[model samples]
Target: MAPTAKPLRLLAHDADDLAVLSAALQDAVAKIGDIRWDAQARTLTMACNRFRWEAAKGKSGERVRSALQFGDVAGVQARNLRRDAKGAVVELLSMGFEPAEEAPAGVVTLTFAGGGDMRVSVDCLDVALADVSEPWTTPRTPGHAD
Candidate 1:
């Protein structure tokens, strides 16, 4: 039998960590599974299929349920956030956070390749990513420069 992928749980406490997490989540496909924000809890949770790097198989198909908790969240905004987005296979292109000038809170923006984006306005950066399903082999292989 093929080796099973170990369950992954990652925490992002700062900008650098968030960058790493963003890179890991690049090309991840999401379709509005459990994407929501809790005003009282000050947290934003999203469940999606996150592609992960495998030593033996390169990028593998892995499902991940991830969450970002901003202790001092002020508000949230999104563009093209829809249940019908399921048909388009939104691919995460990049992620970034911008510090606020007037308030303590900042904004974390997740940009998708197909022109959709989700922005999280928060006081601080706190995020986590975890694998929620068994990984399966994919046909995509990593390209070599040389």
Candidate 2:
């Protein structure tokens, strides 16, 4: 059964704000084909099925379709990814930022499981995450070993 909840809409304009968004996006899974980097548009966007940590009440949980986007992206670099394999799926673990030499400009790193990660150089911190569809129940809530 669907919970009585509103879809999440968020924006990250600073590191603190991004930390909140990063937490919300933790454990989101997506296909490589759903990730896009538009050089001309200076944006990086990804469509993900995000585990709804906010809505996770006890063991009951859900996954919702979400769109994560970054603006003013100067460039992007990836590691440990099979870019050639469009069907490859990735689970996002966390997102962090390192400030550049200039103020407001920084590199945002998206770390995935198994050491795969993407580093995005940005003109400034500009990001948005929004849930686009109704959530469906998941079989289990995510767990991590200490």
Candidate 3:
């Protein structure tokens, strides 16, 4: 049988607020990083500052947009946000995942958000949120071990 993998547990904390995570907030704070995966829990984990962002009203009044910026005024609009009024729609755009816009709820979600986009790992040691297919391989004989 294949070895069973354990789930990843992370922590997301806003240095500024240290409370709730809102799009209005994430857009304001600059740095973001957290531990992603570990055979066991980590000690002295390393994190990097993430892109600084700013939020502005989008084309639609209900929707808010975020842009990634550095140093000077931010110019790149990254993602769009609004409440989930209709059925769920998850989209992959340039900045990050869209529609799943609401900051992860609960301490667990906060931790998971710290993990960032599961599609691409923020850190090398991070594990996938889903099953990763093993790379294709050709059968080998035990003799090949030599």
lDDT string for model 1 (21-116, tens) is 787777766666556678888777777666665433534443444443444566778797675554555667778888778544578899977577
Per-residue alpha-carbon lDDT of model 3 for 1-146, expressed as tens digits? 12432212222233222222222223221222222233233222213221112212233111112222111111111122212322322221122322122433111122223223222212111211211232122232111112
The Cα error of candidate 2 at residue 124, in Å, is 0.3
Q: Which candidate model has the greater TM-score, 1 or 2?
A: 2
Q: Note the clash tally of each candidate.
A: 0, 0, 2
TM-score of each: 0.76, 0.96, 0.18
C-alpha lDDT of candidate 1 relative to the true structure = 0.68
| Candidate 3, residue 76: lDDT | 17
Candidate 3, poorest ten consecutive residues by summed lDDT: 69-78
Ranking by TM-score: 2, 1, 3
Determine which window of 10 residues in candidate 2 has minimal summed lDDT.
Answer: 1-10
Off by over 4 Å in 3: 1-20, 24-35, 39-53, 60-107, 110-146
